[model samples]
Target: MMTEKQLTDALRRRDEAAFRELILRFQPITARVIFKITGDKEETPDLVQEVFVSIWEQVKNFREEASLSTWIYQLSTNKARNHLKWKKLRTGFRLSWQSEQAQPPAGMNHSLNMALEMFERKDDENAITMALQQLPHNQRTAFVLSKSEGLSNPEIAAIMKLSVSSVESLNFRARQNLVKILLPYYNNKKS
Candidate 1:
């Protein structure tokens, strides 16, 4: 088996086999991370492909300071965030046009499908998702890494380029905010 450096060197040299090996090895993990961040299965496949393409383009500059997996995680995270931001911008534009025309947007049905309605009818999962979406980007990233991805605070800190204590603080605040948002619904469900 080739070391990560060897694989990276091969990729830098544009070795097809090495690229295939890298993709086969990392694609599932990349797809999972993208899905967790965006919660969109349809988009995850293409996004994962884009991330690998980025990795291929940037592999030459990869300093071996961090583990390859960490580098890949960082790349995927940035790509996913950028994609989400673009999506939000596009949605905003569509919303504006719909308001002008007095018509529902083309993708409103999909948006409704992706909404937090499950929180109203079911468990805390969708509520967590909704609360996560409400959080600032860094806070949400920290929270998701800590909770949904089952990463330690230190690992999240490394991936997010923040201190461990900052990751911990973000996680704490995220939990507080989530609880505050969900408590009423939770109590009503029990009652």
Candidate 2:
């Protein structure tokens, strides 16, 4: 198997096999990153493809100062953010497209699914989603990166181009905001 550098070199030379190999190598990671940011499984697949297309166009300009994974992560982050912004501008509200189809088996609890269906009927999920959308961009990104993608602070920092300390600070604030917003629901559920 070729190293990342060799693969990148081949891609730069416009080798189709190398491009396919690169897509195979990075698609899952890119998908995860985009999905975490958007919380929209239906949208992630197309967005992941867009990220790779952007990478193909921009690979010649890559400076190699950071690992290729890091570069791709950063690119994925930017694309996801742009997608969110574009969606907001186009729709006049941020539309979430999270489909049950992509949820982890562990997260697909029957009771929770029933509860979510009830909440949907009551439009409560929209409230929670709106509250999450109210969070600051960096805090939202940090929270999603940590919780949804299971990325560590160091990894999020690398992706966001922030210091580790900054990532931690963002996550702390994000959690605080989430707790405040979700407290009523949590209390009701407990009761």
Candidate 3:
């Protein structure tokens, strides 16, 4: 039941138990940050592991000026950015992985495929994800942290290394752009 500061101190001293606690406490947030950025569930587990590994090596260098969670977030976001860069260079396109959904029955006709796609499960979430993918990386991250992860502007600013006003601006633009992107989809559904 150690506090985050005590746990960080133990981790700085290279305690295995502290590292384990760190994993248990922070892995989910780290995973979510990377996964939202990359949109790849298959890639997230490995990326989370890599984030912890980097943190393990760098814990001794932590200056404690920021909260431990902030540091972890900064590390996770940086790693995710690097991963996206490397992936884009290798693949020449961003891979937006869809959520796991029920497979269509085999041997469907083209019309049936179109009809089924029109009524697909998770359509709302998927459409929102598509819009999110369309946003620039900073805007997307700022939006997700603000809206999805329920983080405050100051926390997001720390994670993004931006001023709080900049974070606010990013969130503002993200919302406006998302409304523009998703308005047609909702309108189409009503037709």
Q: Whose TM-score is greatest here?
A: 3
Pick by TM-score: 1 or 2, better one:
1
Task: Write down the lDDT of every candidate, Cα atoms only.
Answer: 0.72, 0.74, 0.77
Considering summed lDDT, which 10 consecutive residues are worst modelled in model 3?
99-108
Per-residue alpha-carbon lDDT of model 1 for 1-191, expressed as tens digits?
78988887898899989999999999988887777777667999999999999998888888877878888989888887887778879786221112213322343333333333546555546656654554445666777776777888878888888899888887886676556556655666588
Candidate 3 residues 1-191, lDDT tens each?
A: 88989998998888999899889999889998888887778999999999999989998899999999999989988888788778878988633222113121221232233333543555645776666765567778898888878999999999999999999988997787677656665676788
lDDT (Cα, 0-100) at 90 in candidate 3: 94
Cα misplacement distance, residue 119 of candidate 3 (Å): 10
Q: Which sections of candidate 2 miss by over 4 Å?
A: 94-134
Report each candidate's C-alpha RMSD, comma-separated, in the order given. Answer: 7.3, 8.7, 8.5
lDDT-wise, the better of 1 and 2 is 2
Clashing pairs in 1: none
Task: Report lDDT (Cα) of residue 174, candidate 2.
Answer: 68
lDDT-sorted candidate list, best first: 3, 2, 1
Using TM-score, rank the candidates from best to worst: 3, 1, 2
